[model samples]
Target: MNYDVFNGDADGIIALLQWRFADPLETQLVTGVKRDIKLVEQVEVQAGDELAIFDVSMEKNMSALEQALAQGAHVFYADHHRSGTIPSHGNLDAHIDLDANTCTALIVDKLLKGRFHTWAITAAYGDNLIAKADELADKAGLDAGQKAQLKELGTLINYNGYGSKVDDLHFHPADLYQALKQYVSPFDAIADNASPYYQLQSAYQQDMNAAQAVPAVHESSKLKLFVLPNNAASRRISGVYGNWLANQNPDSAHAVLTENADGTYTVSLRAPLSNKQGAVAVCGQFSMGGGREAAAGINALSKDDLAAFIDAVETYYA
Candidate 1:
């Protein structure tokens, strides 16, 4: 048996597509929304089975993966998440890189030497690594309109992965991947599958509109903070809101915090365009892991820590 485990997002889907396209094989896919990082435990791999894991970090699910490897299964993992010490195992082939500029799609592209460069670019755009995506797009000879279409598709696909639960999404990331597989590129998919693409675009617009309507909680000269209620739409809107706020106020840091079902909060932190660093440190105080100097995310923070977290953010900048 061969199991394909990936994060249910554009980068993961495109990475899996490249791997499968490179070596056409029959494999059971394991995936979930962006928040569902423990997807490897869902599968039951027997001895002699092979596993391909992408996007999801090996460190976070090291125990389950170690057990699978111990049972004689060979695992190939690629990811960009912050990983702790990687264990040495004969059957494990890990390609873990935590560089903010690198994603699973780009990793696969590097491995394959741009065999599927366009798809890698789309995944990069979807992951909000715009400068990197544009560089690849320029190298691939994509014109302005083509780049825009690919970016829209990438953003839509990325947005679909934002919700806290499956029901909150416009389409499940796996289903979106299945749909995408039919077309060779994002523009092809948008042209061939007009209905689904339009539907997703419309839903994205609605979510963005709702996000824009939310009043800012605090608007200082240097920072703007917004708190959203615990709702499906809020989960989907939080990231978009943070990005929008950062763009609207280029000189100020933005924090968009969404309340979760358990009375905790999921936080998206973005530094000003002028200073894109320390968000990971801010989230670290609340026990979250993310990348780069510009942006980071915390999965959940207890209600008790909310006040302290805000104060820390204030002091960090002060």
Candidate 2:
């Protein structure tokens, strides 16, 4: 059996899409909400099975990866997250890059020699490597109109992954992947009015309208904090909203907190775009928190620690 395990975000989805597009395969897809990075543990592999993992931290899935290797499964892994230590296993082929500007889709793009270059650029945009994506788009000679199309498509695909659960998402990641696979180029999807691109555009605007209407809960030169009510719209918009906030105030760190059922908060933190450093470090201070330097998140933060988290952000950026 062949299994393709990846995160549900645009980067993960596009990375796998590039691989499957270049080398078509019938495989079982294992994915979940964007935050569910431990997808490798969910698969039951046997000797001789093939596993391809993408955009998920190997550190979080280390034990499951070891189990799969021990069971004789051949695994191909690629990601840009904090991978604590890579295990040496003949059955594992790991391609990981921790560069601040690199993502798994870009890694695959390099390996495939840009066989699906446009799709790779979209993933880069989705991952918030905006300047890098723009550079690549310019190098490819894409016009302003084309670049904007890719950016919106990428952003919408990314926004679709922000929901707290698959139930909150407009389409399951697997379904969205399937829907998008029909297009050899992302522009084709945009050209099709009935495509997921248009659907997501409408949905995203509605959600953003609601999110933008809410004022910031706290603001300062060092950091800006916003607390959102616990609801599907809030959950769906939090991460993208953080991205928006960071871009709007490039010199200040931004945090978007969504109230959780248990009175905790789901936190998304973005370091100042002017200095994309210490976000992962700040988030790492809390349990259920880990991400790249530019963007990080805490899965569940106690309401009691909210003030402390704000203090930490302010201190770090101060």
Those runs of model 1 whose alpha carbons end farther than 4 Å from true positions after fitting are 247-252, 272-276, 287-294
Report per-prediction Cα RMSD to one decimal: 2.2, 0.8
- Output the worst ten-in-a-row residue range by lDDT, candidate 1: 286-295
lDDT of 1 by residue, 137-209 (tens): 9988899999998888777777778778888887787787777776665667778756357887888888888
lDDT of 2 at 247: 82
Error of 2 at 252 (Å): 1.1
Q: What's the TM-score of every candidate structure?
A: 0.91, 0.98
Candidate 2 local accuracy as lDDT? Answer: 0.92
lDDT of each: 0.80, 0.92
lDDT of 2 by residue, 1-318 (tens): 999998888999999999999989999999988998889999998999999999999888999999999999999999999888899989989999998888999999999999999999999988888889999999999999999899888888888898778999998999999899989899899999989998899999999999898888899999989888989999988888888888898999999999989999999999998998899899999999999888999999998899899999999988
Candidate 2, residue 41: the lDDT equals 92
